[model samples]
Target: MEEETRLSRLKILKDIAELLNKGTDTRAVLSEVLKNLLNVTGLQTGWIFLVDQTGGYQLAAHENLPPALTLNQCAPMCSGECWCLDRYLDGRLDKATNIIECKRLEDAVDFHWGETYGLTHHATVPLKAAEENFGLLNIGSPNKTHFNKEELALLESVALQIGTAIKRINLTQREQDLALTAERNRLARDLHDSVNQLLFSLSLTARGGKERSEDPEVKETFSYIQDMAQEALNEMRALIWQLRPRGLENGLVSALKSYGEMLGLKMDIKVKGVINLPGSVEEAIWRIGQEALGNCKKHSSQEAVTMYFTAKEQEVIMDINDEGCGFFYDEEKELPSLGLRSMKDRTEALKGHFSLKSEPGKGTKIRISIPV
Candidate 1:
C-alpha cells in the first residue's frame, strides 16, 4: 500500500506538471492546478495565494472551500497577521509545515458553541523558486489533522513546481511586453517622419495660397483647405502619440488628457480613489480608452465627452460617454466594427469586462472594469 500510494502521488504530480507546461494563462493554469490537487490528492480543500508587489497576498486559486471560510474572509487570513504568512515573511516557512492549527478556525469553532469544525489544521508550503518567494500552497482536511513526513515531502515538491511555473510565466510576459513596446516605438517613428511631415507641408501650402489669393471665394476655399490640413495634422500627431505614449510614464490621466487636446475634443474628466495600478492593467485601460475616444471623434456630432475613472484596492473602472450621434448596435452588423471589436477583445484578454450602450438617436457609453 505504501508503494502504491507513492506511485499514485508521483502520477498526480506528473499530471499537474503537464498542465503547467502548457503555457496557459495564469488564472487558467492555477485553477487547473488547484482542481487537480483536490481531485488527485483527495484533499478536503486547497488554495494558492500569490504575493503581489505590495507584499499583500491575493488568492490566485482555490478549490473545495467550505462555507465557513468564505472567499471574502480569505483576505484577512492572507494578511501579515496570519501565522503562515508571518512565518513566510520571517523566512521560517521555507519548508512544508505540518499540523499547524489555524487560529481563525479555532475561533470560528468556539464561536459556534464550541463544536468541532470540519477543519482543524492545515499544511503550508512556501511556493518559492531560487531566492524568490511567490506565496504559499495550503491544504487541509476534516479527518486528517496532521500530514506525515512523506505527504509533506510530496506537497513541497508540488509547491516547487508551481513556483517554477509562475516564474516562467512572468518572464514570458515581460518578454512579450518588451517586444510590444519596441514595435510601437518603431511605428510611431515612421508615422511621424513620413505622414506627419507631409501633412504639415500641405497645411503650409494651403496657408500660403490663402495669403496670396485676392478673390474672396478663392481665399475662402484656400482657408478651408488649410484648416482641414491642420486638423489632419493634429489627428496624425494624436495617432502617433497613441502608438508610443511618452506621457503615460507621467500618468494615465495626463496622457489621456493630452490626447484629447490633440484631437480638439473638449473632455470632462473625473477621477476617484487611488490611481496606482499594475503596468499591464494601466496599459489595457489606456488602449481601450484611446479606441473609445477615436470612435467618438469619428461618429459623434457633439465635440464634448465625459470620462470617469476610478481605482480601488482590487479593481479599476473607467466609463467613457459621448453625446454624439450614435448608431444602431446589432450583434450581427455593428459588432464587426474594428474599433469596437478591438476594445472588447483587449478588455476580455485581460479578464476584464466591457460593455457598450448606444442607439441610433441616443448617445454612446462605454464602461470597462478590470481586476488588478
Candidate 2:
C-alpha cells in the first residue's frame, strides 16, 4: 500500500513534467496542477499559493474554492504569519521527508480563509527549486482529520517535482530572450555595413557634384559626373529596399513584382500560405529573393523567372527557379559570390535554413525555409 501510494504520486509528478515540456502557457499549467491536486487529494475546495519575489504569497490556482478566497489577488501572508509559510520561506519544504500542515490559523496565519468556507484543516508544502522559490502548495478541507501523514508526504514530493519543472521553464524563457537579443544586434550590424555605407557614398557624391556644377568648364564634367552619381544613388535605393523591413503592403508577391519592374525583366510571382508576416521575416525572405533573382540575371541564360512563396503553419518556404543555364553547387564551392553569401546569412540569422539546387544543364533554384 505504501509503495502504491508512492507510485501514484510519481505518476502525477511525471504528468507535470510532460506539461512543462509541451510549452503550454503558465496559467494552463497552473490549472492542470490544480485539477490534478484535487484528484489526488479528493479535496472539494483548495488553493495553490505562490510567494512572489517580494515574499508575499498570491493565489496561483484554486479548485472549487470561493471566488473571494481564490480571487484575492493581493500578496499572501508573511512568513511570520504561519509555521507552514515559515517552513516554505526557510526552504525546509524541499528538504522535508513528509508533508507538513499548520492546523491552526494562528500557526499559519491569523487569517479567515477556512472560516469563510467553513473549513478547518489544510496542508502546506514548499514549491521551490535550486535557483528560486515558486510559492506554496496548500490544500484545505472542512473535516477535522481530513489530511493524513502519508498524504502530506505525497504532496511534499509533488511540490519538489513542480519546482523543478517551473525552473526548467524559466531557464528556457531566458535562453530564448538571449537568442532574440543577439539576433537583433546582428541585424543592426548588417544594416550598418550594407545599406548605410552605400547611402553615405551617394550623399558625398551628390554634394560634390552640386558644388562642381557652379563652374562653367566644370559644368559639363559635373553633368556627366552627376549622371553617374545619380545612377549610384538609384542602386543605393534598391539596396535599401532590399534591406529595410517589409510589410503586408509590399509582401513577397508585391516585392517580387516590383523587383521585376526594376530589373526590366518579365517575371511572375505566386504566393501561398499566410501572406502576412512580421517585418523581420519579410525582410529575410525579400533578401533571399533578391539574391536569387540577381543570380538568375547574372548567370542564367534564360529570360524569364518564376518565384513562389509559400507559408505553412510552422514554416515559410520560397522557391526561385530561372530558365537560365545553371551551374553546379559543387562548382560554386571554390568561388562563392558575395550576394549568395549575404542571402544565406540573412535566412540563417532568422533561424531558418537555406539551400540552392542546380546542375550544369538545369536552371538554378534557390530554396529557403523559415520558422513561423
Candidate 3:
C-alpha cells in the first residue's frame, strides 16, 4: 500500500507539472494548481495566499472551501497576523508544516458558523524559490487525522513547482508592461511631431488667409477652417495625453478629471470608499471610461456629464450618465453598438458586469461593476 501510494503521488506530481507548464496567466495557473492539488491528494479544500510587494497577503486561488471559510470570512485572516503567515515571514515555515489546530477554524467551529465538515487541521507549505518567498499553499481534509512525512514532502514539491511558475509569470508580466509603456511613448512622440505640427500649421495658414481676404464669404470660410483646425488640434492633444497619461501615476481619478477638462466637458464626479485596485483593473476602467466619454461626445449634445465611482469591499462600481440624444434598439434582436460591445467585452473579460440604458429623448447611462 505504501509503494502504491508513493507511485500515485509521483504520477500526480507529473500531471500537475504538465498543467503548470501550460499555464500563462498567474490566476489561472494558481487556480489549476489548487484544483489539481485537491483532486490528486484527495483533499477536501485548498487555497493559495500570495504575498504582494507591499507585504500583504492576497487570496490568489481557492477550491472546495467549506461554507464556514467563505471568501468574506477568510479575508481578515489573509492580512491579519496568522500563524502560517507569521511563520512564513519569519522564515520558519520553509517546509510543509502540519498544523494540528487552526485558530480561525476553531473559532468558526465554536461559534457554530456554517459547516466546516469537521476540518480542524491543515498543512501549509511555503511557496518559495531561492531567497524569494511568494506565498503559502494550504490543503486540508476532514477524514485525515494527520499528514504523514511522505505527504508533506509531496506538498513541498508541488509548492516549489507553483512558486517557480508564479515567478515566471510575474517576470513575463513585467516585460509586457515595459513593452506597452515603450510603445505608448513612441506613439505619443510620433503624434506630437507629425500630426500635431501639421494641424498647428494649418490653423496658422487659415488665419492668415482670413486676414488677407477682403470678401466677407471668403473670410468666413477661412475663419471656420481655422476654428476646425484648432478644435482638431485640441482633440489630438487629448488623445496623445491619453496614450501616455502622466496623471495615471497619481491615480485614476486625477487622470480622468484632466482628460475631461481637456475635452471641454464639465464633469460632476462623486467618489466613495478607497480606490486601491490592481493595475489591470485600473487600466480596464480607464479604457472603458474613455470609450464611454468618446461615445458621449460623438452622440450626446449635453455639455455636462455625471459620473459616480464607488469601491466596495469586493467590487468597484462606475456609473456614467449624460443627458444627450439617445437612440432606441431592440436588445434581443440586434447587437449592441460597437463601442458598447467593446465595453461589454472588456468588462466580461475581467469577470465583471456591464449594463447600458438609453432612450430616444432621454440621455444614456453606462454602469460597470467589477470585482477587484
Candidate 4:
C-alpha cells in the first residue's frame, strides 16, 4: 500500500511536469495545474496567484471554487485585500503554511456573497525557484481546517516546480521582446540615416534657393518648400524617437528636453537637488514624461512647456505645465482618455501619486511624486 501510494504521487508529479512544459501561457498553465492537482490529490478546490514586482496579484488559475468566490466572474478573488497576498507582499511568507481560516472566505461570508461550500482553510505555499520568489499556490478540501506536515512538504515541492516553470516562460518572453526591440532599433537607424538626412538636405537647399531668388513669387515658393521639408524632418525624427529613445544614458531631463524638441516644442526645464534614481524608476518617469509632453503638443496646442523636477533623498517629484488650450477635467469622473488612465495606472503601480489639472482655456498641469 505504501509503495502504491508513493507511485501514485510520482505519477501525479509527472503529469504536472508535462502540463507545465506543454504551455507557454502563464494563466492557462496555471489553470491546468490546478485541475490536475485536484484530480490527483482529492483536493476540493485550488487557486494560483502570480504576483508582479509592483505587488499586484492576478488569479492565474483556480478550480472548483464555491459560488461566493466565483460570483460576478471571480470578482471576489480578483479584487480587495487578502491575508495571503498581504503576507507575501510584506515578505513574511516564505514557506508552506496552514492558514487556519482564509480571510477571503471570511470576507465573502461577512459580506454575504454566497456559500463557501465549507472551504474555511487552505495550505499556502510560497512558490520559489532557487532564490527568486514568484507567487503562491493554495489548495484545500471541504471542511479541512489544517494540512498535515507531509501534505505541506509535497505542496512545497510542487510549488518549486511551478516557480521554475514560470521563470522559464518569463525568460522566453523577454528574449522575444528583446528581438523585437532590436528590429525596431535597426529600422529607426535606417530611417534616420536615409530618409531623415534627405529631408534635412532638402530643407537646406530650399533655404538657399529662397535667398538667391529675386522674384517675390519664387522666393515664397522656396520658403514654403523649406518649411515643409523641415516639418517632415521633425516628424521623421519623432518616429525614430518612438522606435528607440536615445540620450537616456545622459539623464532624464536631457532626454525629455530632447524629446519635446523633436515634437517641435521648446522645453523650459528646471532641476534641483542631485538626480539619482533606480533604472526602473527612471524608465517609468521617462515614459510618463513622454506621454505628458505628447499630449500637450497634440491637444494643448502649445509650442512651449515648463518642467520642474525635484529629487530628495527619499523621494522625487516632477511637474509638467503647459500654457495652452485645455479641456475640462474631473477627478471623480471616469477617466475620459486612455493616455490619462495609462499614466495613472503606471504611476500607481510604482506606489506613486499622480494628479492632473486642466480647465478650458486655463492650460493643463500634471504632477507626479514617487518614493524610493
Please report, in order, the local distance difference test score of every candidate based on alpha carbons: 0.83, 0.67, 0.85, 0.89
lDDT of 2 by residue, 1-372 (tens): 978877877887787666656754555676687687778667766556667554566566667754334324423332236666667777665643323344434322355443334554567677777667888777776554355677777777777777777777777777886687567656756766776676567667756876857777676666666676666656655554554423326556777777755665678778786645665787677667777776776688776888887888767898888867787678447326788888888887776887887888888878888876
Residue pairs with backbone overlap in model 1: none
lDDT tens digits by residue: candidate 1, 1-372: 989987998898999899889955877888888888878877778878887544566788877666556635654354435677777877778899874677656655656523334778889999988998899898998867889888899899989999999999989999998998999999999999999999999999999999999999999999999999988888788779888986998899888877876777898999999867888888888988888888888788888999999898887899999887887786555574888889999998777898888887789989999878
Ranking by lDDT: 4, 3, 1, 2
Using all chains and alpha carbons, the TM-scores for the candidates as numbered come to 0.67, 0.48, 0.67, 0.83
Task: Mark the 10 consecutive residues where model 4 has the least summed lDDT.
Answer: 275-284
Error of 4 at 315 (Å): 6.9
Which is the leading candidate under TM-score?
Answer: 4
> Mind giving the per-residue lDDT tens digits that candidate 3 earns over 32-120?
87897888777788888988544567788988777787847565355556688778887778899888787677777777667888777
RMSD of each: 7.3, 18.7, 7.3, 3.4
Lowest-scoring 10 consecutive residues by lDDT in candidate 1?
Answer: 71-80
Task: Tell me the lDDT of candidate 2.
Answer: 0.67
Q: Order the candidate numbers by TM-score, best to worst.
A: 4, 1, 3, 2
